[model samples]
Target chain A: MKRWIPFILTLALLVPIGAEAAIVVVVNNANPTEKMSERELIDMYMGRNLYFANGQLALRLDHSPKSSVRRDFYRQLVGKTVAQVNAYWARLLFTGTAAPPHVIPDKSEVIEAVKKNVNAIGYIDEADLVEDLKVVGRID
Target chain B: MFSSIHTPLRWLICGSCLVLMAWFISPGLVNAQVINDNDFKVSGFLTLGATRGGDEFLGFRRFVSQEGVFEDEWSYKTDSVIGVQFDKKFTSNWAATVQLVGRERIKNSFKESIDWAFLKYRINPNLTARAGRIGMSIYMLSDYRNVGFAYLWARPPTDFYSLIAFDYYDGADIVFNAPLGSGTFKAKFLVGSSENKFRFNDSAAEFKLNNMFGASLLWENQTWRFRYGFLSFDFDDSINQVLGTDLVADAFELADAFGWDGADNTADDIRAEGESALYHALGFVYEKLPWTIQGEISYLDTDYDVIKSNITRYISVGYIFDEITVYGMLGKGSQTSSRTKLPDLPDSLSSIPLAVQLRDGAQLLYNASYADQESIAAGARWDLRYDIALKMQLDHIRVEENGTVYWASDTLPDKDRAINIVSINLNYIF
Candidate 1:
């Protein structure tokens, strides 16, 4: 009961009430990588580990500021808010410990970038999928 | 001879030239972190803050190395700072990065402002090596301590972070990461030499750490992270340098005057030359959704008697409510009872000026480590935008007499007192 208080208050106190999309992780079709696991995606996205199962370097694409899909994606993936994710990256970024992922505000731009690079990994709303990309995993 | 490292104007010219070269090499430029299609990038962070309230004796200093001390006033000198970094990747396996920070520094020069300039060589997907002046990561937030946007609080808890300060070590390190169970295991071994220049009122002191060896181990999963670290270093010079007076000479002159010469824990134990010290720390963080909790405990062991051994620890808990985070923290720093004791001068000679000199000086030495204090803080952060945030914090600190380690005092009292401090910060990144 004590642990549930914060969770209950969060739902009751949150200010933004918008429709959430089912966020999906996608890769270039040219990539031979099979379905990625949650652990692998987390590692890649967070720069904890930069290699895929195929032993190839992985590049990640991120959503721009205030994107609803980005918020739901991090909350569903790591149980953290977008601000928390940014703070985590800031720890690594300013220190030159790791480089942040490239950001694309438009879904079309992300799709095109993914199609051009076999090492690229990105995510989007399942409803906005272009079908040319491979759906490796879902945030849920 | 060691003064050569203080040259900053030459470093500034070189830094400017290099930045210009990077700019021209990348004819096309995008936003921060992305410079055209080329592998060169630039990024920066800044914070302008207002801090007020504290005892006049307690100088508002963030760390020991900084020269500017906020003396119980509404001063911006203590919190306003800006930093810029340039990163150039030559190839898949080779890279170089340079970072420069501008703020109220020890010397207010480029040498003191340049935090990190290192060359990285990726050995494989799991292993990497870095040379040149590398950023030291003894604590969890040491890497990003300057980037206020990277943290939820207006500042890191003071009791723990302010205990000791060295920006980075001038040396090399190897970092390795591997999959261990459901989490990632990371390890680093580093060796280097570092220096800190501190100013207290009208006096200045220099502390140099030579022949330093350290190791850090970390393991983290989705919701839990743990870290253990160890560092050993030798003082480059007698810690009497901290007193800024010929304390060794004073100790010996008094020893000769008194008959208890060569006695244990007495004047004989005042040899503080080049003592080696060891530091160990353990920390952990648990974050899931709207809840976050983290804590760290560190111990410093030194054989030097006057400079007593020390320990510091803190724990913080925060709850996230969408764009705003409200957090509370508790932190403490104190001297351990593990030091050679100096018996009070015999009552017969207590009134003598020489005996008084030795006793008062020894007491001051002991009080230097006593900047002892226990503090509790509550703060709130509002993320106004993706790149900007506003934060305010209030700290109530109970100061113990003789702990000059954190405060500035002309004469330290043997009493304990309470003081409150408030800070407001606007943090941003680009």
Candidate 2:
């Protein structure tokens, strides 16, 4: 598992949220961020950066804990398994070091979560992407 | 490994502090988490472990506070534990966290389980400060050592991690984190007084650490993290079980005072108070897919004779294969400095019972504090499910002459022994 952590951190090499889930990272249209890199995406999702590229606070959102899309989203964005990511957060969370992103459920809820807050950023299936949500990055 | 404020009234005081901090942050630490989710959250982890083997009389120990490892018997006390955490994020910039762990750490009380209770205030995106009781962050894993599912080992290497039995400090610290190129750079500074523990059955054996100051720096990028930590404190311990309650220090002082034949007037060299010690460590972790490597080397330098100056180091390499991970580790700890000198008494004078005791006690104090030992281990971890893991390990250690102090035994061994320990553990998080 020690060795497994390295492959998980090489975020640039892999982008499959799952082997087949084509996902698109989305933010409220009100959010000025029009593009996102995996690095920037990882920074926000991993609690390293809480503000959007435009210097506005970002209310990061995620799928429910058990949601497969949520699992793949982290794998695609950071090359880490959901368990590894959870352990990482456990260290920070239990230590009062950082706050994890707010969690909403799967599907339209993930999209609705982004729409309700201008500072929100979330991921949804590319097919589920709606006009109300601005696509920042797409994971194949 | 933890000490909590005793008395029901104390909880009210702790609660009052909590309320005050919460009230203090409300007047617009506006960065409060702007989320709709419930602000209070709870989480926990558990580990069920048992170990068998090793010297029956010499007993294995993970912490100095532990009476002994289940010892040559399959006992769950060595690693079995459960910890629960509660967190309330008041705002984006303010929060409170408390963690309680249940284990066999002799305080045998609920208070001893309180490992962390602190108020966190984020000064900015790149800086944060915390107050109250917090874990001793002097080592790479000290922050989360109790969470078994977070790491790959059955337990931290004893030779290195167990050298200093301190658990947490009551004080404050400021942490700074910022992006450095493609990675992150973190710096921390802390100051506070730590705990003072009494042996389970012995009151004279008190361990007190005061006026502690510490700092650490870490640089991490994809696949690798490097860290260095430094801490110092004034230590005064009268552990009768090991060093005979300052007998060696007093013996030397008297011999030098009376100018014993071999005494070079160096009695004042070791004192009962004002003794200070410094600790420093360098550690690194690297991971790249199927393989990971981690290593750390730490040194404890002190003028005190009981602990003397000591150094410990370990390196672990692991490989993952599907749901299972296999790993091996090498570790060693040694006494680096000696603070005792034998008296040069004539054979005829040494025959006196008092003189014989002085020489033997001095010899015992000089050699008994040594933790010189080396160990090698192989282990396998199976993560058959998302939140659970099963681990099995076999450890072989060879103890050096007079190095039995690391064990739980009070009497020094007549001869060094080689021992083996077999362990199995089940771990989970929720």
Candidate 3:
């Protein structure tokens, strides 16, 4: 009976935890460029090099705190964790130097923010991409 | 041939073949269900630069490092550094981070080491507690000053941050956030002691593990923000007793030369006395259509036995125009002690007392002291690119003793001024 109970709980928990989702980079449709290399995307997102292909300052949008897509994107591209990002941002904020990218609650909000400004760029789950926002890059 | 001829040989050959096969195939098999959710990340930055300035009394003009060691005037070096941070999240409410910095300060120490290492547990939406090497809440820029790309200037106002250089403590802190009608307010409480030892002259200097407490409240909206903070530090005397004695002796020798046996030595007697300091700072930043300005003011008080109270204040203003930022600062402070009291001393062959000595070489010369200082600086930043910025700054300092200027040198180009500094820095982040 004890073994059976453990097996039942494992079955209930494993199903949802194993699911995988798509990762997509979203930029304003008005932005001239439709594609970006992984390196370019990294440079842009990390605040290393900010000029877009059209030569305008790229204002980045980020996911709200602890969002799954935010975690996935930074882990894959920037190679940092959420806590590290927080620490990094703290250093920036207190130093009166750089500020973090703007953040929105979810993919829909990101799309809205990006659609309004040509300089805006963000990422969302592949399933969440809206038509008005262009997908500039994809992470497999 | 041996395997075919003997059982032992056959077993050995079979084992060797199995090991070789496993080595090539095991890795692929092990990779089947590693289950990486892409929830870990790594990022970092590097800052490398050299500085030169005029009238560097004690080499105070360059970045804070050992080699500068209080040298005077023209110097160059790159003790600037690079650091990397790693962060991971195991669950929604739990996260961890480790930061490693490499700098020339600690014998080229590679371990900039654990600026913040802690496990954060969030009870609900508005509260969290973290225990580990927690950052101090004392000064606004203390936690982040090491990262240059985060700020427009090559460095923070040294006059303020340098006085209290210790910014991190090994301990735990709690934070609470509340919504206050169209704005949010946050409060943080930290209690801990520094585990590291700071040594001077080949021995550990005094740094008491006294209570360190601070409270700050910040309110922000789309275009405006205001913050106020108070920090109270309790510590035992950190000055070396031998050094204290030397200072006292110097004062007494000056007094004796003037034959002022009636003058007060209260200042000299206070040497080696335990002292404490309280620091308070306030700042307000405003951003609106086409303009952004920030102003900060700070006041600090240090109470020591022999020295008069030290009061210091710094005020700064900045304006943002597109990608260009222009700023300036005015700082002033003073340290003074009462001259009313005199230490009695025998004069000539008589035990009789005479007029209280006020001369520099008089016996009571130690009781009379003065330190009045003021600094003015102006600078600007131009963002040539998003991640790259160019900044230039010029600063002038004036020192006054009892309403009369002192210590001014010709190279400084101004009396009562020891140094005039011109600095330029290029800042970038990766």
TM-score, chain A, per candidate? 0.82, 0.81, 0.79
Q: What is the C-alpha lDDT of each candidate?
A: 0.76, 0.74, 0.54
Residue B374 displacement (Å), model 3: 2.1
Q: After superposition, how far is residue B407 of candidate 1 from its true place, in Å?
A: 0.9
Docking class of 2: incorrect
Q: What is the TM-score of chain B in candidate 2?
A: 0.85
Cα deviation at B169, candidate 2, in Å, is 0.7
**Residues A16-134 of candidate 2: C-alpha lDDT, one tens digit per residue:** 43357588999989888999987788778887788887777787777766777887787777766666676677666655666677666556676767777788888887767678889
Query: In candidate 2 chain A, what residue range of length 10 has the lowest lDDT sum?
Result: A10-19
Separately for all candidates shown, the number of backbone clashes (residues 3 or more apart, or on different chains) is: 4, 11, 18
Put down candidate 1 lDDT per residue, B278-372, tens digits, no spaces: 98888999988688899999898987666667888999999989899899999998878733345676667777887677666665665665547
Instruction: Point to the candidate with the largest lDDT.
Output: 1
Off by over 4 Å in 2: A1-21, A54-57, A64-67, A103-105, B1-38, B196-204, B237-248, B251-259, B262-270, B338-345
Write one digit per residue (lDDT tens) for candidate 2, span B393-412: 99998988677656776666
If scored against the real structure, what TM-score would every candidate get?
Answer: 0.87, 0.85, 0.59
